[model samples]
Target: MTVSSDRSPVTDAGAPLDGFAVEGSEGSAAADIAIRQLRMLGAASPGPDVAVRGAGRARARAEAGSAGSLVLAADHARVACALDWAGPLALPLEDEPGVQAACGLMHVHGRSSGGPRPLAIDYASAVGGVLSAQGLLAALIGRLRGGAAELVRTSVAQAALISVGQYLAAATASGDERDAPAAPGGPPFTSADGVPFEIETFEAERWERFWSLLGADRAALARGWQPFQHRYAAAVCPLPPELHATAAARVFREAAGAAQAAGISIVRVHGAAGERRRSDAAEPPPWRLTGGSSDTPGPPPAPCRPGAGLPLDGLVVVESTRRVQGPLAGHLLRLLGAEVLRIEPPGGDPLRWVPPTVGTCSARFLALNRGKHVVEADLKTPEGRRQVRELTAGADVFLHNWAPGKAAVFGLDSADLFAVRPGLVYAHASGWGDARQAGAAMGGAEPLGTDFLVQAHSGLGGLVRPRGEEPAPSLMTLTDVLGGLLSAQGVLAGLLARCRGAGGIRVDSALYDGAALLTAAAPSGGARRPRWGPLHPPLRTGDGYLALGPHARSSPDRVARALGADRPAADAAAAVARLCRGDRAADVAERLRGAGLSATPVCTDLADLAADPRIAGALDTGGAAFVRSPWEFTS
Candidate 1:
């Protein structure tokens, strides 16, 4: 709980993770990376109370009773079958899964890319690792409060499911009205001179103005706004071809200048060299933490309620956030047992009325905001601001994803909130950590901190798409989800510090930071030259596609033997596809699993997810078809 920037305080009583152990599977980088991140944040002391073991050794260590808190990372299918949880219920099942570009991760990338194709880069695996880390942190907080040892488990598939939950929610909603088709198309428009870039603005007028300034077709401008604006929620933005044509007519600088004049933010998609330059630049940590004190201190930390099973039970979080990241963080906190009181604008969140609904609520909105309490408050008014302060006085945490500096405009910043709730764990899930720095990164114009733009600016656009394809950011709200996870993690860490007698703390997590973390972990070469592709694209079968997880690339001979094909030394995708083409996807998947490899039929349709046996137990199909909280808490 010490306030030094250099010290690790993410533990109970500032004690290291004395008995926590991680065992099983070498490529379970998610668990390893999560543990490593925690340790870097001071979860572990000098020596290793946190233990890690390779695959097949978990049984021996469990029997020995030396492994304390344990986290296991495996392929989505194995984890799903063993845990009987729907977890990720990945689209692309694969043999020998890891954080490779294929496997379950491919499904996520494909969703963002407008279909089920492999992302040239690794995203889901790293995200799953972060999810595992959050689970571990929540468990540690529980232990800090004198709860028994907790079991934390996650899979890459589960992580994938969590990321795509919003889409699934809308897709799985029952009733007469079907959600709109996920028609393929989106941004990062390529200019005439061959510079690719993304444009962003939440306001429709700005979008219209920017396009008109660039002499885009007037009819296309009017037709394109809704899809462009809703891309975050819809997972696709099929802009009219005329808009692309317009961008294609201008040079990069001319288009950029027009966008600047129109008050729209635009960023060039960084190539390999640009990605490397950005990667080498210093960036903020995933989440920045700072201690704060109230002139008037609040009561001492409350004791954990007796028999309360969830770590955050009895705590209250007042969440005022629009869009995905902040609300998702609040949702995670709610799942962890905090009573989340959501502050919506007058009337309600407009998104509540958007598209396919489960009852009166937007199924997509419900995906992130199902169980929270709600109160309408117009923050633009003084009374509304006063009401928020009153709510904060009784809350343990105040979380938001407001645009940078908006809080201060309303006098609702951390300093303002600390005045009311002295021990509040204030969290701001931001687009860019600092606008000035972000502006510098984009060469003077402060790029909008939206997901796609962040992806373009942070070198993800190049890495995400495969070679020979147009480089563009995955429009899946990727950084927003990652930012949300980081925000919740920060809140839990702050609360843990408070449980150990620390004062109020402020946590700021940014989409830019999340993008930076992913880029930093990727192999060098940025986007101009991708170092990896889908290790193995989903193999086509008689019935459907079968994914041979990342491990398939490692054990080609075994895979070849299992499929009765030659070892694929070259053209592995075509070879693997040919091997499975004669069999049903299920048959191919089963055969690979029998051969001691991870495999499953690719779940191309979200509507069919509830019926999938591997994860049916974890899904609640009575309403919207969203996966339950990924963590299974067992004391």
Candidate 2:
């Protein structure tokens, strides 16, 4: 559906600007984040005529003829409504017996050394909202080209699936717990000043340097931790707290500094809140308009005939990327009916060899590259560069995630590619934005823009703390997932503008920028951060555990009655422990839910997820089970 022209952009000060505007149906942090991103894209706020409503009801109403391109943003419940699903939204981390079971969060959390609580963040919902917005924009763009208006849907459930898609694929492929190991844990070590720090060494040279810096005994090295993978595996295995404490006896800053100087990555664990960085005002917008007259090849490419199903039908994209972010963007486009050709180096994407292989392909690789065709080309070689340029001539979108200056070096930069295909949507995904911004942010160094480093740089580490403990990085690659979606958003926007007669544009999305947007709703200081802990902590039942939502705190009387306790709210922990000792988790959860409390039994393993009817239908069964992108379109 195409947006009505009445919508316009509005700033925080309430002044309406001249551009497309978006209005949210509900007031939610996730919705706010999505709107902020839209503003960054130069869209204005919607006028009064465009009444934004809950996505669930909107979809139902939309089907009845109010079908214009619509963007729906909400938490999981609203998403469930849009999909016409029964019951509450099954959040992966928020509730027990959630899709986390299918995604392997329970297994990983069980093995974590920190505590029983899983990584606490609404990342799935946040990312889902962003992706949903992107999908809406794509659908709207299609509508502009004469396609029927459609409802583009995304949910925390879908975001949850994307976050753990690789892990779930591995689990399904291996069909054995022992075969699918969790990613490394960035083992915690204590400094001499009693400060704890996490260290990550994913390379053999760096690992050796770390050991050498620590003056490790020869016997320790002989323990067979030479290979990088072995060290990664050893780091994640349960370690004694005392060992970390002893390691922390060294001066924290000094130790970290020394390790870093020797080319190791280390960060001290602290509870300090993340400092907000400057806006993108000094640099170009996350996605910018470029190559208008000087590089134009006349008007935008002619609209192609729409296909039967996907909104992006007949769109051709040439994707030159590896790893998660760029490939994920291409994957999303492919799901929406775009033809994506992944261009890899001679040896293929490095991730092709990542662990938990299904046949010859890594589960992670399979998850991201499922629908696309792939070809090998060395951009450094003249023949290979010529071949890529020839492909660009016929492609509508050119997507890549090369480092800042590598694009120009390889003659694949925006200026170069736009010269080849003046009407192409040139999209670049990176660790940071332009070279100046990235270099400045990294203290004049141009480091590789991997997911973990981007998380640290973007201040995500500061936002999540394990109650009373030091901050930890998200086990889920939150930044990578969001950054990828943002890239896809940029591409969609570019395509829409092109179709509207704007010349070819250059779209840039960075992991750092995406991370900033993820936490934009947070107050600068003194505002109460949402408590990561459950309002009612997990209760131990006879057979398993149950997680109850914080809303139950409002009616302590009801909670007490449901748990069969007289003063459960007074000493809630003890009361729940005493009352649930002999009851089954599923029974307690059902009873609490019946009493109007939000609660569910904690899923213990993949088997529980596989049995869930709601989750099973979403998994692709062609090979090892993996999630398909969460989108449904009607013409």
Candidate 3:
């Protein structure tokens, strides 16, 4: 079913794309793009390729091999295809010849200023896609080191680590997040009137109070009821379906009173929260911001300006996307200097409608669609299909995030796009992929949670399984887009394989997959804390929260004295605030370094941090603040 394009892969075909593109849009060309404009603006593309298609061996070899390679999209519909190696004649794959491809897409979704309407946690998965990219890269690197067929390694650490880094980079870069508001906690929905409700969504309990203020029985007053406590007990009973609502409300009010009265909490439930509002109200981590209100780019950095010049450039990419999952693929690719073009339908990508388009479109949309060219097209239309066929011609990589069984509707199913673009690294992402989680429908229109659905359902919640689900839903999500990032790594590995003399490759990461990756630490390890990766967590200091390291612990030895030690010199202000803040009934800890002991500190304002030159510098465009890919090239 491979559709052959009559173009010169080596020499151009007679208008090879002549019959493939949609009418009226035939004059497009990559050379026509303002690549110079982009590169001048600091957006370089992936550079040269050493692999070239050999003398007619690709098709010939494919015809000879029957023990075809199996491309598994998930645990279900596992595919077995005659995957022929065309690298010697095409692009060098990034990994070995065989692989037991990982199942599912890492759905890392986020609600950028401009993104599709609140797709909820679906966006978390969308954002998580960045991790997929990191993991795949790290994994491919690992594979390149050791040769083994049917084997692939992923960076269990890089997925979450890079994600955290991206967020931190975004926040610290502009020092805006320091002043950003906390995420809004929305209204608490009640089931009709009678059924009681529990505060589960968006840290609701932080605002309101829990209660059980059931009143005492009156009839019993005349007969046997005397004590108000007894009546309250019966009224507050959880077993009675008839009394749940009344019991819940009374408990709510009483708890609310006690909490507020004790200066413990308040209500934050109200409306739809957006990026600006959330960032404005967001409780920034207690770190000094080095940069001020500077949103300016640094002297218009060159494309792929990975400091020393080493970077991935001249890379070609086709993002076959819709909603969050697909666009995120382009997002990660763009970060690394790939020339990523987003193919959309006539009205543009469906996600353009996302309430707050963040990037150049919707706020939410913009947040995820950064770094890409948008082309209006309808794959369903012959012209649209033809255009994609034209645009993707000779592209280096391809990615599509579509729901199960729906890929063909737009001719982007696993086989469609890849067949025509063999050495083109390919990636696919979806919920309940073509594997075991396939067939089952998603809850309502959205798939799942905002930031922690995988935590609520899959990670901690234990929900999605081999196919049985509840009619009643509990959450929304963004973890799936993680597939885009992780998938990037997978695709890169494939490309790398060709470089190392292997065949083509396929990569997948689902919300569930990302969720699975998150559960790395041994559940608390009874007494020991887990590794925090790279640097240790931060701690409360004389002024604010600072990342304590051997620097913090041995500082006393290096600078002065210890806290509880009598007659100690150099008793720095570092541990002053922490000494007095005891954990209610327990003693505080001073351990650091090997233990990675870091405190998250009590909730506080970030005004001080935003004003700190060091913190600002750390997040400034001059340092770790700017969005620069970890790459460089020798001029």
Collision count for each candidate, in order? 11, 18, 157
Q: Give the Cα lDDT of each candidate.
A: 0.69, 0.59, 0.32
Model 1's number of clashes is: 11
lDDT of 1 by residue, 433-493 (tens): 8888777767885666788888887777777765676677877777888888888988877
Off by over 4 Å in 3: 1-311, 322-325, 347-367, 438-452, 460-482, 501-503, 521-561, 564-626, 630-635
Cα-based lDDT at residue 41, candidate 3: 14
lDDT of 2 by residue, 1-635 (tens): 01111222111111111235455546444455565656655655545533334444545643342112234332321211122111123432333224333344444444444322444444545665576567666666666666664555555556666766665676566523225343333444657777555555556667555655665554453332432243222214433333344355557766666566767655544332344343321222344444433235445645547554666888899999877789888998998779999898898877787666677777768888987888889898988998899999889999999877788898888878877787788888887666575556544454556555555555566564434555555544667777788788878877766765666677777876666655554454201234543343456779876666656645556776887875437666556666777999778767878787876566555435654665765677654777876776654
Models 1 onward score TM values of: 0.86, 0.82, 0.45
lDDT of 3 by residue, 522-549 (tens): 1221111122321222333453333232
lDDT, candidate 3, equals 0.32
For model 1 the local lDDT of residue 285 reads 45
Ranking by TM-score: 1, 2, 3
For candidate 1, the C-alpha RMSD (Å) to the true structure equals: 5.5
